[model samples]
Target: MPNERLRGAVSARELTTQRCAELLGVDPKTVERWITRDRVPHRAHRVAAADLLGVDETYLWPSVVDDLRTVSAGRAEMVEFYPSRSAVPLELWRSLIQQARESVDILVFAGLFLPELHDITQLGERARQGCRIRVLLADPNGAAVRRRGDEEGFGVGLAHRVLLSLRYYEPILAIPGVEVRLHDTTLYASIFRVDETMLVNTHVYGSTAAHNPVLHLRRVPGGRVVDHYLTSFDRVWTHAKRTSDINAVIAAFDGR
Candidate 1:
């Protein structure tokens, strides 16, 4: 029992639970149950309530089930998939990154597009504001990049991309609350995690990362995909060498 009465998203919308129930033609207790259980009403009811309450359905009834800190929000599945990583809107990325207060993680091989796409300065500010940012990059000289290149039909070309991308992220070393490391694991996916939500790009058998679709996953009760990837990231992170130690190699690649 997580003090259901006091957790009032309704207050933000200027409505009471009783009024919400009336708008949905449900009993006040049912609405209370929905709140207590951290669940949303039926689709039609939620739509009506959203219209009546003047909030987006997502705002009016967010995925309480996937809110990592909440207890027992009910059993539900809320996974979204994108056609490609580039297809994911920039606004979503900015929102997720800006809103993250606890932890942020990135796992990728040749993540050259990330620095080009998002503002690294904003990420540094987030680190300054107490967000723990952990980044795992592919060891540019290691076998993992070689394997990834062979698999992607590029044959070591991606190693250059990895080196170039590392240069873009190197300055973040001076930022507090951040760690950058290099791993040699055969990467199966490129992950961008903000707190409990993640955008995972699964590597295709013989395609470049840009051609692969991205899966947007939120942590939800009774589901383990998000947790599974989180565990994978943790394992890789533990085995990775800190960039401070790997800088010699990065320097060797410079002026090439």
Candidate 2:
């Protein structure tokens, strides 16, 4: 059977077999055989081709699961773990944001510490340099925010913090390639993605985010953890309100 997945991935990227061969340092016929004959490439080529096609190696070749399981690829994706979100170094956070070439995505209820740690204006410089920056905050007017506040014994304080965080993010909202959205969903984890590296803060009941454990994950071929979080981010991003709607909500809250 033909390897439709490989064929589709290459086609989706508009890469010809010859181009892929050139990049993979293989003969063009070999590339065609991998797709048409379902020939599994060597481990190195599998990794290289997957990275180039922007998909997991297993997605292209399901039978190549032995190496992933043997190496514990999921655990390998973890670069570090902090006892709590507060335990993550400020320098590490700064370095991640500063080094990001492609994207910076933040998903949180408030995440007020971000503005406190780094000047939010610096994100504009990143956007100018062609980094796509996305900030997803819990909508102050949403039920989830209120519920979170009550759960944390903060009452309306959490909502207020969200408003304040939005204020800090206000300037960057108008910048090209920088998007701010309001999500009302129950947040299980707060994800801070700097390209392929992510810091995932897992939420616990009745605990503030500062007290939550953070897993620092970098994407690895055949790993599923990072992709799971990325999919969650996309789902939330899809249904979230745009900047104009969030601004109106903030304005209304301020007026009252």
Candidate 3:
């Protein structure tokens, strides 16, 4: 059963289309359009829905539950922005994954799984070392891969270049001890958990995320942080569609 606390705090009654439109200050036809497009009440309407339900707007969107909880505790979270062209220096990211002994679960958005850029080869080595390594990444697609090519020409056609970017990380995915999944969500961040410690790297460029901040969430075990991350990862993984026909390498571990 869902938490009674959560249910008691939130009203489950579904609002009518007309009622929802009235709350959002939009014409009923506009609401119908949103339904047709599947965009729903969206961010703007979220606020109004919360007011209607007499609950925190976060309640309407299950994802925001963590943010609401985090804020209520007076925890400080930073948001940093950087231009798209300049690379983000995240050395801690490498260290976290490299030293994992028991398990490593990673969630990344716009991460180039390249051996040269990062020690992706090390992931395979760790996998062979009997550590559980799972990576969830955004799928390369129209909007996702659009900027990669225009930023720098990798001497390949648009599609091939995108494929190459994804292929470069195949060694990590092919590792028998690792599970790789491609997710399609705007939640652009990676959580690398090494046992009890968690390092969250937020990779963003341009307007969507300014000064992409990497949040390091730390607390002892049983705080429910790691469990929450695992749940989120699984949600993305189960919904993610698998990528097919990964390139084969002569020296698989070597990433040749």
Candidate 4:
């Protein structure tokens, strides 16, 4: 059993032993043991566990337990939906993107990958209009493809084809405001934030990526905890790669 003091600090939601065990491919008993014994898992496993819990490492393995208690007590209104149409609401995406007068940062497997969605002229127009437009995408051709250079196999891959078409936005490489990267991590997640507001897309509970539900949440006044969550995203953005590396594969679909 965990220390009585420690038990007092962890919330019911954060103590999701059953869900964490499912994600870790372990029995719920094992998860309880880890928490009871205060045995920290490997770094990668802890990160995975945190993702499964829909919170950050700071929430799970924080240096100060009191901080976790403080944050876990706070809550925000949330909405969940799946945009079954060809694309998520363009107006909604644009609204979030446009709100970034200081910067627009997107991190996803494929950023605006649908041909129907590539509107850099408009995006660039936004950039030109002074909103700092930026993105961190998985390599457009990161996944192994049966076809030499076809773009329609994977849901995210198909969406990537549209992003590859707009190359003039060069130098949108992996530098602070702009980045493109590929990761094999199962943390296939998407986030959009405008100041304190955040929209999180979870690729869970669906057979495929496109059908997964997205959760939208806004930061209430005087509640700034979401900022730390956004900060974690910036950390991931900092490590992403450039589009140039996957140009060859993406180029093959020209005129398709």
TM-score of 4: 0.51
> By TM-score, is 2 or 4 better?
2
Per-residue error (Å), model 1, residue 207:
0.6
Candidate number with greatest lDDT: 2
Question: How many backbone collisions does model 4 have?
Answer: 4
> Which stretch of 10 consecutive residues in model 2 shows the poorest summed lDDT?
62-71
lDDT of 2: 0.91
For candidate 1, lDDT tens digit of each residue in 101-140? 9899999997888888777767788899999999988887
lDDT tens digits by residue: candidate 2, 142-247 = 8999999999999989999999999899888888999999999999999999999999999999999999999999998657689779978989999998874556
Give a tens-digit lDDT track for model 3, residues 24-46: 68887775554454333455465
Candidate 1 shows a clash count of 0
What value does the lDDT take at residue 147 in candidate 4? 27
Tens-digit lDDT track of model 4 for 186-228: 3445676665556666554333445656656666532334555
In model 3, the runs with Cα more than 4 Å from the true position are 1-91, 113-117, 142-162, 203-205, 208-210, 247-256
